[model samples]
Target chain A: DAGITQSPRHKVTETGTPVTLRCHQTENHRYMYWYRQDPGHGLRLIHYSYGVKDTDKGEVSDGYSVSRSKTEDFLLTLESATSSQTSVYFCAIRGLYGYTFGSGTRLTVV
Target chain B: GIQVEQSPPDLILQEGANSTLRCNFSDSVNNLQWFHQNPWGQLINLFYIPSGTKQNGRLSATTVATERYSLLYISSSQTTDSGVYFCAVPYQGGSEKLVFGKGTKLTVNP
Candidate 1:
């Protein structure tokens, strides 16, 4: 509940299709993060944004790209969806007290 | 990246039981956090204890930065407390990117 809201709570896409997830925050936080959670892998970072138009890759950045044109919006894109990309994606914002996470988006690639 | 290991990967406790979940890290961390992923796949931040101890209601967390470990205690647990508990710490370079452990799956039964 870090004032973060992720769109398309659940999505099912075909292989090779392009998919994008949006994370919007109202807190005007300086940092935003994208992470994917799988069965064995607790949670793996995909990308992060430090400021407007300032983004960096994370541990699992392959097949994913992020854009942050505004401080309140961060978008995660899968150029081409794959079966391995099916997982629950989470958006987090760094708060003064701690980090806050959204409800998450569940993506399924068929 | 710092390595995080959580003990008792799986734990089943009866209602009203008390449990301690441990998270051991391989390096010093500037931020340590505990999160509970609920049944609906929502991540709820429980604690952001970089060091020292903090308590909120039935949950308490302690992080020993010197020892590179953190502990979460749940008292009088209820069935709603059943979920995967994750402990995350930042990468060695002090980046906001977090490295998460596999997590401890706790099942509270009536």
Candidate 2:
């Protein structure tokens, strides 16, 4: 609850469709990250933004993309959703103490 | 990329019991954190113990950087403590990009 909010807490979509998730932060933290959680795989980094308009890919960047055009918003997009991408997505903001994570978005691809 | 490993992949305990979860990293890290994913799928930041020890309420964490391992101790566990506990670390001298372990799933019964 560190001033972070994720939209569409739960989503279900068919394969080959486009999907986008939004993460909004009020703390104006300098770093933002997207991660996915799955059974047996833990949490895998998908993408991260160090500053406004500055982004970097993570270990599991394939089939996904991220954009941070403003300090308060970061977006994760799936160009063509697939069942393999079904998982709980989490967004985090880096603070001096540690990271603050959003509640998470449960996305299912049918 | 640093590799993180968590032990005792699954744990079950009764109320008032105490348990320890361990995380080992393959490389040196400057940042190490512990998180609790509640049944509601919210990732709660538990600790940011890069070194030394820190405690909050019924939870305490110790990180022995020299040994490349960290331990999270939960005392007087409750049914509310049942969820996944994850330990994550970042590569040496890199941005705060975390690599997470598979997590230790804890199930506490009343």
Candidate 3:
């Protein structure tokens, strides 16, 4: 089992739909991040949470929102998903050595 | 905005070959990390070398904070090592946001 895991390993949703992706960590790391991976864009941060109830925007936070009601859970929600949002999303937590990532969630917005 | 550049966007090597991947940052950062994204799309933390050098098995990483560059070296590469290697640093000083480079794609053949 991974320390961090993302739900809905594969999702296909229609455009303009509201979708939520869950990231759960067994360890209570204070810092959590959501990033999307695309062909040419590499991995771009969508949002990051420094602490419970304290989240901030990243470079690519336009169509996404994040929440951390509890330390082990960081949620990423796409409001009115667009076709351009089709990408692989990864969740990670800052660890003593570095960031440990979860197996990505492949989301396709058709 | 700080710039993170990775060299040798693509690489190919025969089994047992050694390789070096480089990452250069435009400014200094408190945190620097190396990650490997496997063919299964699983992101694994390889190293967290802010400065100095660290080694693990056949892999090693060195970061020169003063020069704002890091290098990841892999020895005796195997076919299983074929994937993408990424280097990341804080988006800027005093921020927890991690910005990733475009990554270097590596292909190891038998």
Highest-DockQ candidate: 3
Candidate 3 Cα misplacement greater than 4 A, ranges: none
Clashes of each: 0, 0, 0
Model 3 pairs in collision = none
How high is each candidate's TM-score?
0.98, 0.97, 0.97
State the lDDT of candidate 2 residue by residue for A1-110, as single tens digits: 97999988999999999999999999989999999988878888999999999999998999998999999999999999999999999999999999999999999999
Please give the C-alpha DockQ score of model 3. 0.94
The 10-residue segment of model 3 chain A with minimum total lDDT is: A1-10
lDDT of 2 at A92: 96
Docking class of 3: high
Q: Taking the tens digit of each residue's C-alpha lDDT, what string does model 1 give over B18-90?
A: 9999999999899999999888888898999999999999999999999989999999999999999999998
- What is the alpha-carbon lDDT for the whole of candidate 2? 0.93
| Ranking of models by DockQ | 3, 2, 1
lDDT of 1 by residue, A36-96 (tens): 9998878999999999999999989999999999999999999999999999999999998
DockQ of each: 0.86, 0.93, 0.94
Residue-level error in angstroms, candidate 3, position B21: 0.8
Per-residue lDDT tens digits for candidate 2, residues B1-110, read 77889989999998999999999999888889999988888899999999999999999999999999999999999999999999999854565798889999999998
